[model samples]
Target chain A: MTREPDSHYSSGNEAVIGWDIGGANLKAVRLSREGLQVVQQPFAVWQRRDELAEALARIAAELGPAPCAAVTITAELSDAFRTKRDGITFILDALQSALPETELKIFGLDGKFHHPAKAYQQPMLVAAANWLATALLVARDLADCLLVDIGSTTTDITPIGGGKVLAEGRNDPERLVRGELLYTGASRTPICALVQRVPLWGGWCPVAAELFATTQDAHLLLGHLPAEQCASPSADGRPATPEYALERLARVVCADTELLSQAEVQAIAQYIANEQIHQIAGAMTQVLSRVKVVGPVAAVGAGAFLAEAAAARLGLDYLRPATLARGAASVAAPAVAVALLLNEEACV
Target chain B: MTREPDSHYSSGNEAVIGWDIGGANLKAVRLSREGLQVVQQPFAVWQRRDELAEALARIAAELGPAPCAAVTITAELSDAFRTKRDGITFILDALQSALPETELKIFGLDGKFHHPAKAYQQPMLVAAANWLATALLVARDLADCLLVDIGSTTTDITPIGGGKVLAEGRNDPERLVRGELLYTGASRTPICALVQRVPLWGGWCPVAAELFATTQDAHLLLGHLPAEQCASPSADGRPATPEYALERLARVVCADTELLSQAEVQAIAQYIANEQIHQIAGAMTQVLSRVKVVGPVAAVGAGAFLAEAAAARLGLDYLRPATLARGAASVAAPAVAVALLLNEEACV
Candidate 1:
């Protein structure tokens, strides 16, 4: 579950660990003089919230306890807490527990870093702010570029120009309206949310609005994601095997294996995948039209292929975050960015 | 508090009590040869789910317990239960405890009544199915009509033609996509849901997507609902008074009375109300266009005003359910419908 440090990892000196704690996953990056050491764990926080401190301890152990920690979180949006404030406080408390002696800085929505006390005061800023860190890092590399970070449950499309994050939205709803934020993501999104109708045998059929299948199922069937990670059904509470995924997708159209063959299911997945791409492409177009700079789009996240497809569809130049940085750092860009920012500030 | 029944002089010879158990309110009707006697109590089931048996017992005591009881429920959709099945079983258990000796007939979505065990077998049919009973009752009287039943949290639009219920959707999601169901309701629906844009001094401004005010506030500000009833903050979590409602509504637009006068706030409320009507009116138009029979629209539920306005907009005859039946029965049509059905079935 943990990727140990490579040979290039610097000694404990000038070392910083970054954390992107989400509802379903805990990702960490340790940035040293040599390179980025990343660790990812599939932790459904809601199910085992009490074990958060323990999970953090495990990730921290992987990084070998860096001098300072830079943490950003979206897990506060989960229902484990009554309010965002509670989620933020709980997450911060866990971070404090994970690194009791180390200096910790939390990334805020205002594009600044804050101490735990200050971050706790403005819980909204500290909550779900990993996107800002990634955008900030991307802005550093390419002053004029579009940052497309699509994860499991959401998408962040930020315009970076003149070494500044040109974002019209500060909060989730505002971002959603301004096309800087999209609720649709590559994985965990229910297939019903992608399209109203699906192309069946020869005609278009209206889809059943049930949680029978998700975008993960579509992407899995299409071989976009590794079969092992194709569909981690933390919420679906079902086996995440391809056979089970087939059954789940078939049920979406009110069919079963007996009625629908694998080819038919694959066709459904393709139609769904195409619609999802169109969704992101539409949002990308909106943001692209509003901006004055003709910058290339930077595709990032576990769902980076979506951004690549979207940029290609728009006939815009595409830049991979992995090309700009290491694959682990690119996939876990926010964590790496925050860690770099912290390291640079400490050196200053 | 349970409202005691008046002495309309119906001894127990042919009396039958019908129940409509919603998540927030419990409405009951005692039907006899004289008339339909209704009693209502505000019982928040989610707050104290275990007290459901006790709450039902109190309500049944108000009606003095008839020999036969017919029940329809929408509370199964509440979050008190793990699933609709669990909710149905819990509700059935509560009803059994409340009326242990009474011959019970539970209304099912299949347009028929079933015994407790039979109804439990088909939990989905028993869940949020009070509307079907009312629609079926209305269908018997007026074969061709569009039924608009709006409650505190949701609305149901059913098409009745050829003396049968004609619906494009059966469940909530299906009904939602088919336009037969709308999550927007009279009392508890957040104002932000009604309209995205609201009238400012001269221009339309997007309202803050916050739960500052609900539809109850708009209705209260317009003087449609009485002040006593207007201030029912059971679910709204704020004082429902005109003065308080004004403050709450002002918050929706991120304004205050000093900055945006009472007239402006009133306009906002009016704008929201108009948009809500337009929403239902639009749905009515969609359903009306598909049906061949040109029938009068039956307006029921507390939000019947919206239906009346919708009927006026469509230039169709508006028939008040209250006029067709008792005043209380019309207001709580599902309970009345079930009571009538129970009374008829008792004779058989």
Candidate 2:
């Protein structure tokens, strides 16, 4: 769906657009003097990476033309391509093909933008830098805060202090080890990956190793996510309804509705949700202990509620990205952040 | 490929065919006065469960019909069906349709064969009982021993003592929690699931959560599995060759062949193989500590070499399933075991 920016952020500066291309979704934000406009689409790049240029062309057309475009990418980590270099080069080529006239600047982990040629030369710099873009925008408002941006497939826990991004890791692999990046998220994570054993029948019941269900089922059953937010496909190829969700969850324990009562299935769902929170909180605790950032946690992305809950568990104050980028832009924080950064630089 | 049993175990009784229907493959063994014969085919029941009857029919024609048919199944645990009951009922129906004239008996955890109608009533008893079938066969030869069966997708560690099966858990869920069932195997398991971080560049680099490479690639590259033994499809659908396996393994760390030397990629393979052995040994330690069995480890299945290594690490002597069932029948131990059991019962 297309989300037009509010008229308040409109200034008499040249229009710019930002793109946060991820493995599962494509998010774009247009910041013009008329206001900020945001558009996000669920694109399974791994399956249809060949058509990425067409998908981008459609979104670019809807968002209209701009003189310059700012881009940050985590799609390079998708298994669709062999390496980050292949993914980065393919995405940059798609962007160029889709928006041939625009001056494209690739966002890097150093919190700066580079030419597409430079991005191709050193792809790791542009690989998975979407978190840094959002952190840069958050740092402008709050000098010392933990930025927790949880998207559909991953979570980024970056520490911001002294109006600078205090991230110990510069890339995804390093970030994962340092507890600055968590593979768990709101919707796309396989439920089996989150918990090896779930509570059932007053005992610990191990789950099937297969991808029988996903976190989308857990969050949907628990009402943590609205129906529209479950953009990913269900594990069973069924609709994202509560009944099918319960059916999918039942398979996790090698049981079915005939064996497990609705209440029993709902309890499993609750356990799964609780386990997700527990894991996210554990990672946050690790990061907080290491970074020693004593400030409110600014939660962003579509899974901001999960981040906020994680923050509460650690007895830390919580802030919203809306304090900086209001409305739908908050959910598409990385895209909006890059647009704003490029806009400010253009104005200068 | 169809594997005919050698003429060594021929006896004067009505022939009985045993079947072990797993999620990833179908195995069948026939025992008669003429001899014993074994045939295993890679049939992804999860993807084409409807064609199970057809696949069984083709195999049955090759092995010839028997007076009675015995069956033990783990295919019902596949996500292709909603629950174990569904998987059990579907597989039973396939067997009935494929061998309409043969008397069909379902093998259960109790080490006995029940009528198909009775099996439907007690589905869990018949679900995932293949390991039990093999254990019963082992108990006849070695009264006190640990049964380690490592297949394409899972490993089962069942302890037998006093010529009796002493299993603490009968079902997959319980077995998983008790350390008797390890979801990791020599092949089919995603490398990311075996270890979250792999040793790379003299440091631990976290792997991408996607199914970029599987244990099949690691085993195939390290020569643990011959190309012919890799019956399952590769992660990238590439041919089961060392060169392609290396390419797939490189992607485990978000690198490519150009970025990593062949030696570096081989090191990752060695690490994955070691971690798998370490995990199996850890589980064996848990089982031994609880059950207090001082016997040797009887390793079987397509991944028997892996089980042998794990057994050695725990300071236990190793035995082969061939001690009980000779030739190709050892690799298809459960199938051969059930066929022999049914043949003995029918003769009486």
RMSD values, in order shown: 6.5, 3.3
lDDT of 2 by residue, B1-348 (tens): 666657876646778888888888889988878788888888888789899999999999999978788888988877677677788888889989988988888899888899999999889888888888889888888898899988888888988888888889877767776778888777788776677677776776666656778899999999999888787787777788898899889877666777679998999999999998998898888788788776789888877888899988878999885545355776788888888788778633
Return the lDDT, model 1, position A175.
62
Error of 1 at B66 (Å): 3.2
Q: After superposition, how far is residue B234 of candidate 1 from its true place, in Å?
A: 9.6
Residue-by-residue lDDT tens digits, candidate 1, A91-151: 9899889779778899999877888999888887787788888888888778888999987
Q: For each of the candidates, give the backbone clash count.
A: 0, 3
- Which stretch of 10 consecutive residues in model 2 chain B shows the poorest summed lDDT? B321-330
Docking quality level of the chain pair in candidate 1: incorrect
TM-score of chain B of 1: 0.91
Residue by residue across A1-348, what tens digits does model 2's lDDT show? Answer: 897567766536888988989888899988888898878898888889999999998988998888999998988877687678889999999999999989998899888899999999999889889888888888988899999988887888999899888989876656776778888878888776777678877877656666788889989998998887787788877788888898899878767777678898899899988887887888788788878786799988778888888888878999885544465777788888888888877633
